[model samples]
Target: MRTDFWKKTAAFGLQDDAVNILSNAADYKSQVLEQIAKAEQRIIITALYLEDDDAGREILAALHQASLTKPNLKITILVDYHRARRGRIGESKSEGNAKLYCEYNEKYNSNVKVFGVPIKAREIFGVLHLKGLVFDDILLYTGASINDVYVQQHDRYRLDRYFVLNQKGICDSIESFMNEIMLVSAATPRIDSRPIADYSEIKLAHKQLMRTLKKTKYKEPRASNKNQLSARMFLGFGRRGNDLNKLIKNLFDQTKEELVLYTPYFNFPAPLMRSLRKLLKHGKKVTIVVGDKTANDFYISPEKPFNTIGGLPYLYETILQKFLKSHNKYLEQGLLKVYIWKDNDNSFHLKGVCSDSKRHLLSGHNLNPRAWSLDIENGILLDDPNKTLEQRIEAEKVQILKHCIQINNYDELETMSDYPAPVQKILGKIKRVKGDIILKRFI
Candidate 1:
């Protein structure tokens, strides 16, 4: 099949509607609750991680309460099966959020359903990392998972982007994609079945899901008269049959002016990096907004005195430093711009990129080896040249920038050693350890 065929099929007509961009967890909670209260038909959610943390429980409680009042309100939650079974770094056994969610459905609420999809075996190179919520004809997309930090349950927060749109065509197409491609696939099993955690079963289900994904055809759904917005969805997998990769290539190849990207991690696949260099060499304006080492991370190992489970911050900072060192001339010439996020006590976890201020991409796909090789990711493409989506993007950019301390010159970077005293000491100790390969996976 030709690549353009899929691209054309995905690029359907849309109508104009008001777009709302939410900046933090507090805003997200308000918006989600508001939508749930008004929902008349159904609520569809997809998340990478859904822990049984305070925030997660609160959301579940709210949903349950809403269902009690509005018995007809149907809710479906799709999360990663593998994540559901595995415990966090310091936790023992699963808190059983998935199981609890299932029980809630079976016992008290007849209108709610939860499903888990294991993506590691399903897409050997990727895992399911998309986060979205669809209610009636409205869609909410974000890069946050269900946790206290993600929703600002206590004092801490996780930096992310939240967007709302009421485009009927886009909403309907995404809903269909969830139902036809995800719900029907073997990778996704009904939570009520009490699926076992066997490697063989996971592998089998993965193969089945891949087969279905390969054969599935996605076309832009016909727009209803009430529709008001134009959007497109893109996936990133498969080798020769992967239309998502082609779509990304086309976006870069066809860009005439500028590209702006927002990703928590800074590492890029070889081809993507080459494409970025090519764009820079061609004098195109490129702005990359990434999370600073400390702010972009997830866990800070309190046990090890400043060690972190995820090496996101270190990896991203190293990549940025290397890129700047290699492309010093480009930096001086104003062809490249890099911004880092550093909220007071928050962590940054949003992902996706926008190109030419006309195209927008949103997903949970962090730009790192873990995301590329072990997580499934999904994002949407929107051509918004009229600045319709600028409000949300700009607001997030500004808020994130507020927490960052800029490193504009190589001289500044060389002298920048203002890490927390404890972190600085920890970094020094880590550099002394020679055989610390085990730390790479978790860090």
Candidate 2:
């Protein structure tokens, strides 16, 4: 049934020679810059945020220059509306990245367009988490947003997967979805304007836009060519009808030999966790790669004062310990394997799933409760029945695991009691009030 569904679904023909999986952030940044510089027809970039840092400025400047270099070039950037309008999380509210957009607009009389997409009326409930970049005929897909660390523009970096495919159909489909659906919707407004539209003004449109994005799939695609993999695009929204979430579980159930899953956070939604437990019970090899507490983006160094958010990594660790304790039998039997990824001061932000060395899901979906029910998400699933890309995928995994260490014991991770004084205080308070249970749903 799953095989029939995939075949019947409209998909793009992805030739082997046209696909390139990047290894590191630096190369991914370079590719973005180069593609922007030379783009002839169009460029569309979508992410949660496009920070106001050195790397962000550099990329924005490149886009402006590209517009000038080619009068016919059309460039568009879309980010979370609420996120783009607010300052740093803890800072007093003020005009945030949108201020920079306005300044750039006036300075260069910019031809490039920047749109703030409000996926929800409130940022707390949900935000636009979609991620993809299309430059002309090439599509660069990743989970990393534009920032100094994400692009490795500085000494510190946030690691994530990068997959580039030179497919015109895929690029066009993404581009059109933005232009026809997102741009036309009043909920998504041009942030480069003198004054941004107030949420009160677009309240009605916001509701309608959310309904459209949640239900719409990309345009139908051309069929796969001979000896090429079949690629399907999935728009993941609400829990009840989320095809991506359903497909992810199906991928787990269909794993004949082994299942490889990667998520920086260990907080899997209940459905995925159930599927994972079933895999272990059935004697299938289940391998999971997660980041150490220190590798969490919310982690604060010992030298720094701990904030409430800093306790999140410890919270994640506590969850990991609980899971490990329950599955110690699987660990002993060698059916379950867990790898902790840690690299210096850098953080890990990779998310995807691969089954039996045949099916691969390349996506930004975090595979958590928030991603399952809150944010707007999307993914590209590549079905390689002939295992054409197996060797390449294995090589990529090898490079990723170099900085990772496998752990067999739950005792290896830090317990809540082992956390710092400030972290312990806050986490203890949350646990006492049962806030921790509510907290896991959003984080």
Candidate 3:
């Protein structure tokens, strides 16, 4: 049943034998390093940002070492331009990731090039939120950046999906997209002494490139996947430009039995909310797995001094409470499941959707308003209409739920009074001023 659906849906091709779903971040990092060491021809990595930390240095060192051995190896990394040169909001001024790139050029002399791509003029409005790592003929897709927490180099880890795809069509398409589209754009290859003013000089070209990318879709020779599995790539930006959004909503509308959503952030765009409401009304099963408030990356301990961003988890919790309240009937009947992921001091950044037993969305898109209308997002849709990967998907779900606890009632979430003094005071002000609505739309 699903095999036919995938045949009809996939624009390109998918290989069943080549798909490998990894267990966790530590495992993912090891595999990535191994692949990097073995890559012979080229290595391309794209992510939101790459920090200059222990893990980041380790990744760069591996790439440089590989280039030293395979002197002909081509390595290119792309990170958000505005984000690459800026420090954290409250942190003291320092040379950001770009400086590290410059140092690698001078010290390693291994021909590893890091490019900065600005999806929009500034960081607040938009960014280069792309995700993929192409090593020779293999493509590694994850929502994680090369950082200490994301790579799980320490006790703290950010939970995310790690999917490995090894198909000629998939590899070629991604490589072509990087070489022809991203590299040709206004992406800066060297920013050693370049000023922000100089970077902004290419703003018009960047805008034009984004427009072109909005209209561009990966084109490759279509082939029937082995074992009846099919996959397609989708990219989008802004509200209407997002094909991933459209694909997810279509999955919701098409779901016959069950739907599962895994997002670190709890917020959902209006369209998804409407589809979910309709699905629930039709007596379909819906499960939402999200990070606990404490697991939010922005969550600071109540004992710590409050930063304005620290209140984000509370705001999301308030929204979840309202959602649960409005859909209490679904909860009572066991048609709705909400699981909150928490693992001590670890955090979460999972994002994907599974519909019924066939279609799975592996993506970096958070499914939030910001992702829907602001950032450049991309993902690959694996439609296994024949249920070829059912066991794998189910196993992945179990892994994700290992540290999660389901919410039986909305009362599990703390109210304003139960929050820390600073969080309570801050949320109280936002609620009074009706600023929560704005934050929902933007954050």
* TM-score-sorted candidate list, best first: 2, 3, 1
lDDT of 3 by residue, 1-443 (tens): 23233233455556667789998989988988999988999999989887888888899889989999998999888888888887776798877777787787778888787888887777888888889999988899999988899999888788899999886677788888888987786645455334433565887887788788788777655654454676788886878746667777788888999999999888999999999999999999999999989999899997787899998998888888889989988988999999999999999999998999888988899989999988888888887878988998889989989999998877777777788888888999998999888888878
The per-prediction tally of clashing pairs is 9, 0, 3
For candidate 3, the clash count comes to 3
Off by over 4 Å in 3: 1-12, 187-189, 192-197, 222-227
Q: What is the TM-score of each candidate against the true structure?
A: 0.85, 0.97, 0.95
Please write out the lDDT profile of model 2 over residues 301-342, one tens digit for every residue: 878966788888989988889999999999888899999999
Q: Deviation in angstroms for 225 in model 3?
A: 5.2
Which residue pairs collide, candidate 3? 2-385, 3-385, 3-386
Residue 299's C-alpha lDDT in candidate 2?
92
- In model 2, where is the ten-residue run with the lowest total lDDT? 1-10
Highest TM-score scorer: 2
Greater-TM-score candidate between 2 and 3? 2
CA lDDT of 283 in candidate 2? 94
Q: State the TM-score for model 3.
A: 0.95
TM-score head-to-head 1 vs 2, winner:
2
Root-mean-square deviation (CA) per prediction: 4.2, 1.3, 2.3
